[model samples]
Target: MTASYVFSVRFRLSPDAAVSVEPETFETTLYRPADPPGEDGWLFFRDNLWRGEVNDQRHARRLAEDALGVDVEAVEFRRFETDREHYDALKAAIADDLATFNADSVSEVLNKYFGSSVEVVS
Candidate 1:
């Protein structure tokens, strides 16, 4: 069976900031065999909270820091093995958004779910 991994990063806003702000967290995911393919060989997902390809942990961390507008204290990542059942369920959950991207296949659906970016290895 092919293996797919989800990469996640957690970040907290700087405590010393001028404005009072609550800490927030964000995450991004990348799929193997990305739709339309990528030069680095992975698909990326960009969201309001986070952006970057899964394989490039540094890029993900930088994206989080940029969003938070503060230096991140720590970053964490987790990987999961996905199967058709899980993938289908995920597709179902985000079906409406996928349609917005005019996704015709699973890869297209995932590409839309994340965002447009070339995958790269660290």
Candidate 2:
């Protein structure tokens, strides 16, 4: 099972750039893996998100710029997409790591980190 934070990135393309595009502004998606809970990168939520949203737009754009090798102008979070199995596993892991987060329950952790932006797919 795998999960990823989907973001919509807007970037600028120079006129000298060799591409068959109409506009200078372009949009694309970048997936940041929401590593399995309790894993090394499990703190992604705490580091990058607040209330189910991106905490820093500029930082996110820089990340997109690095990944796309383009000048990113904006970044917007789309969704946290995952499967049922992965979601359940995350819940279980959160329950295990409750103390570190200083939260009372898994639901609280979810709310604080993800809000209502989670999308579970089959």
Candidate 3:
């Protein structure tokens, strides 16, 4: 069972670095694996994402830059692609921590953090 978080990243050449065709900016898709909901590191989305996008843009940009080996000017979360097991597990986890989120239900919590960006795959 593999799951990943997708993000759209915009990158620009570092000004100090020499470039051949002149400094240019471009956008690319980035994927980061997601841990199981009950496992360590599962709170990554909660800490870094909100409302279907990257809640902390600067932090997300740095992460994207590190992963892509480019200077990321911006980063936006696209979605979380996972299997049904992961989605169910996430719901269970969210239910357990409902008080922490101050939400009345799992759906509300999911909306608050992930919005409509959760995609259950095969």
Candidate 4:
């Protein structure tokens, strides 16, 4: 079976921006296939946090800059395997949001949470 993971990134914005900005954060789900598995890649699911693509570090940085109208000072990414326990907890925590997407599975809920920007790594 493919390995599943949750990916999250935290971004700090430049201080000189015109708009008052808060730290930007995003999360996504990644699916790593076992076959032809040279490097894990993104899974473009319809449902996601930004509702647009935020696949990689560069994309996340760009999104933050664009949304905040400021340069990105730093970005930190955190990833964790979506083992059964973690998945269950996540599902419960986001249960209300998942209902909006009509998601019945963990993958579907993750897709709704992270959209097309989901990344995969081995």
* Residue lDDT tens for model 4, 1-122: 24343333344444566676554433333232212112232222222233433335576557546755655543333333444443444445455455555677656666554544344433
Q: Against the true structure, what is each candidate's TM-score?
A: 0.29, 0.87, 0.89, 0.28
Better of 1 and 4 by TM-score: 1
Error of 1 at 99 (Å): 2.0
Q: Predictions ranked by TM-score, top down?
A: 3, 2, 1, 4
Which of the numbered candidates is closest to the native, going by highest lDDT?
3
Candidate 2 whole-model C-alpha lDDT, 0 to 1: 0.86
In the range 60-94, model 2's lDDT, one tens digit per residue, is 88888888999999888888999998899999998
lDDT of 3 at 54: 92
How well is each residue in 17-109 modelled by candidate 1, as lDDT tens digits? 667565454444433332322223323333321222344556656755775565554443343345555445455645535554466665665
Candidate models: Cα lDDT each: 0.45, 0.86, 0.87, 0.43
TM-score of 4: 0.28
Model 3 steric clash pairs: none
Off by over 4 Å in 4: 1-52, 55-70, 73-86, 95-97, 115-122
Clashing pairs for predicted structure model 4, backbone only: 47-115, 48-114, 48-115
